[model samples]
Target: MEKSKIWVFVSVLCAMFVLVACAPGSGGSPTPTPLPPVSSYEKSIFTVEEGPIVEEKQLMGEIVPSRQEELFFRASGFVTRVSVKQGDVVKKGTVLAEMQVDDLLNQLQQARIDLEVAQANLAKDKAQREYDIQKATAEVTIWKMRVADAQLDYDRAVGIQKEKALLNLNIAKENLALAEAALKLVQENTNPYMEQAVKRSQLAVERLEGLLAERQIVAPFDCVVLRAIIRPGQQVDAFFVVFVVGDPSELIVRSPYDFDLASKMTDKIEVNLYFDSKDEKGYTVSYLPNFLPVTTNKEATTTRSSGDYFYFSLPKEIQQQDLKVGRTVFLKVILGRKEKALLLPPSAIREYKGLRFVIVQDGEKRRRVEVNEIGLKGTDKWEIVADLKPGDKVVGP
Candidate 1:
């Protein structure tokens, strides 16, 4: 039985040895444990370089003429004549429309007649005043002579005759004093009430003249007549816009921007204007030009809570192109630009402890080099200023 148990143990040891031989690490040199796939990681890299780059911003806006205005009237009246029509090119001070001035003319005529009548009445009043003054002077002279005569009689007579004469002379002296006062009052005989009436009549005539002058709508600048809203015999109220004029020589794009954008923008900004007329596939590129902001009147803008007026001149680059008064345009404003700058993909840059760095790759090795200054070239790129020379391979962050 012991010999049988030994044989069984030998058999089991042989089976264990065979199992160990089929295992993965049971070879002579141990098959050299395949090294965890070389511990590799993929990283993206970028080559630093200097080139021209523009930071462009796309904005949609409409086209407008540089000098455009709507002709308006101050007083309500009927349109008597339409001197010009749509698409009529007119010069500055050209009469475009005329309002009915018949009423104004009649009123002016009445004012003139009233003024003439007032002048006649004033002449008659002056004549009457002069006659009163001359008559009062003569009466005062007669009364003074009578006083002298009474004084002579009083001096010459004696007793009762002298008393009677003295009484008569006293009455005459009172009459003389009254006549002198009347003469003094009539000496300065210009009636203040009549003078005021004459002035009022004159002002009426002047005011009517001014109103009559405003009866015609004239062009303020050399422009094309874009529209004439009023026809012959059409009634319009005060400040009603009757004509639309556009000076297309210096075309522009007028758009409204809030105070925030206007405050932060540079004075001269570059723009790309896309023409609205496209042949179905859509426009690929557009005209480029620099624009200046239109000035806003602070006093006129009572509230900045709403939008403010802003405009951009139609790029001089497009001056040779055919355009209309209300042509549609799109603007691509260049917010920033860098000429010959080292631009790198944002992914190639790494941030550590508030410092911006780029990882440079040398074959299979990479190291982070701190950058002195970095600016945003675009949404997905950065303008880096560092010791890294151009064409340096930058690795992924």
Candidate 2:
């Protein structure tokens, strides 16, 4: 019984030792002392900078060709030849179709003949006038000779005392005056009726020739035929747009812009363009004459721009192929620009109730700086023309 008691006491002691070894903070790898939490506050040192920052405005625009003119022949006739149908690509000055112009050709031929006749008549009329003037001059000379004879006869009458010679001299003087008057009238009065007739004939010829040419439809430029409105044997009216021609090589970009900004826009504003891909320096901005509706972003802080669409022809590419028409692109226009100015990232800026402030770390003490936004570095950076120095690290994206 004593031996059993000793074994029981030893077992109890071992049980207590095991409990103490396994208890928390008692032995091996004592509950790893909890580490102090790391601070999550990020830091952004700032420095004053003098650099160029462009005030960029990003807007969407569509690519389009420079010209998309409707093809038409300002003549009414039956379509006899359809040289080019829809979807045919053609060179500049290509004949797209021809109209039945047999009647017009006949009319043109007749007009030419009539013009020749009128020209001949005008020449004959002018010759007739010259002949009349010459005949009148000759008659005046003959009358003068007659007047001299009569005068001589009258003088002889004075010697002979004859009344018949005096009366004949008086008649000769009257005839000479009549001939002079007739010559003066012919010289002063010229007939232009034949010249007017010639002009009328010339105009008729032009009209007929133009009508004959109008029978054919020609492509105005290097274009892709988009549509053929008239078919063979179809009669078209004058000034009918029978074909649609579009040139892809000529291109432009049309987009909506902010109204207030555009109101101050000049035709000489600088432009930077961006395509769908992230490639830069492909195209420069150009000022377009036409305006469009304002572009808006519902999610933007400033939702709407000034109400005006911008139109600019796409500049020639640098070893690049033609841009696709009707494709969407991002256009960045520099509304405002500043050279060599201090800049800060948008993160440094914190907006309050209608006020903008930045938290500047100055010599270990956080200080709030009120800065005037003078310009824009980019979409998120601001170029400030304020009292700031270089070496100020700005901690923001």
Candidate 3:
């Protein structure tokens, strides 16, 4: 029995030691559970290539005339006549439209008649003055002749005859003096007021004529009428546009100036233009920096500048029938180009905190290589200047 008790006590003591060893914080430190192996993250990859890269800019523009004008009436009135229609070829000074001018015409005619009458009256007055002077001069000559005759008679007569001849000579002398005085008065006559009246009538006629002109719309140059906004009996305000005229012989394409694109453009750069209405492929042409004059439209006249446009000429093969003002056009311009350059897909480039880099794959490892400079960026690929070579693999962002 004691031997059994000793065996039981030893078994109990061994169990207590095993419990103490298994309890939390009993040992110096426990071994951590091993983590599962991390799987590698895979991403889309691209290979760098050596090829020519070109960067281009696309623009939407319109076909416009190199020279154009908007015709309007300077004075307000009811429209009485429309002399031209759209697409009518006209010469300079061709009347495009007319406004209510019956009253102005009457006034102009009356003023012209008044001017003629004033001129005639001035001429008549001058003629009358000249006639009076001539008559007085004739009278003076007659009296002097009579005086000479009387003196001769006196030389041939005795005392009584001599006294009568002297009396006659004195009478003739007095008459001649009176005639001379009359002639002087007539010669001194000057009617400046009459000339002034004629001038005033002429000015009135000119003023009326000017007002009549303002009531009509006239072409400023030989051009095709693109639009006529007035019709018979239509009332319009002053400075309202009544026609749109342009020289169709010389056509040009114009676009709103893009400062950013302008800065990148060069004289040697070629432009491709596509007519939207015709759905034609395009014409390769050159571009020029131009200043389009501001339109007479009140809205544009206030805020637009001449430098807000770029001009391009159409190809010679383009027919006038295929073009129209305000027609939409598409333009593609080559902004930059490079030959035999290191090219990479734009997706492969990564940016972080202002740092541009690419994940370059070498064997089984991947590392980031900083992109020092980028050049001639294209739509799909970009030219990257980095520590990379052709056939190098890069991971896409």
Count clashing residue pairs per candidate. 1, 15, 0
Q: Write the per-residue lDDT of candidate 2 for residues 1-397, one digit (tens) a residue.
A: 9999999999999999999888887756745688999855565555556677778667788775555666666677778888887667899878888888778788888889988999999898788878889999998999999989988877777555568888888888898899999999988877678888889999999988777667777777788776677778888776666776678776677776667567656778777677764766547867775543222323223222224467776666633454666668887777777777777776676778877766666667766666666466577677765556666654442
Candidate 3 Cα errors over 4 Å, as ranges: 1-44, 76-87, 120-188, 226-237, 240-244, 249-251, 265-290, 295-303, 313-330, 350-356
> Model 1, range 337-361, lDDT digits (tens) per residue?
8777888887787888999888888
Go through the candidates in order and give each one's C-alpha lDDT: 0.73, 0.72, 0.83
What is the clash count of model 1?
1
lDDT for 256 in candidate 2 is 67
Backbone clashes in model 3, listed as residue pairs: none
Candidate 3 lDDT by residue in tens digits, 175-291: 888988988988998899999999999999989989988888888888888777778988888776667788876778888788888776665788889876355577887786544
Off by over 4 Å in 1: 1-71, 75-78, 82-96, 141-149, 152-168, 177-237, 242-261, 266-390, 394-397
Identify the leading candidate in terms of lDDT. 3
Per-model TM values vs. the true structure: 0.44, 0.46, 0.63
Residue 326 error, candidate 3, Å? 5.5
The list of candidate 2 runs beyond 4 A from truth reads 1-52, 57-72, 75-100, 158-164, 167-203, 206-264, 267-333, 338-397
lDDT of 3: 0.83
Q: Order the candidate numbers by TM-score, best to worst.
A: 3, 2, 1
* Model 2 / residue 291 / CA error / Å: 11
Error of 1 at 5 (Å): 96
Q: lDDT (0-100) at residue 26 of candidate 2?
A: 78
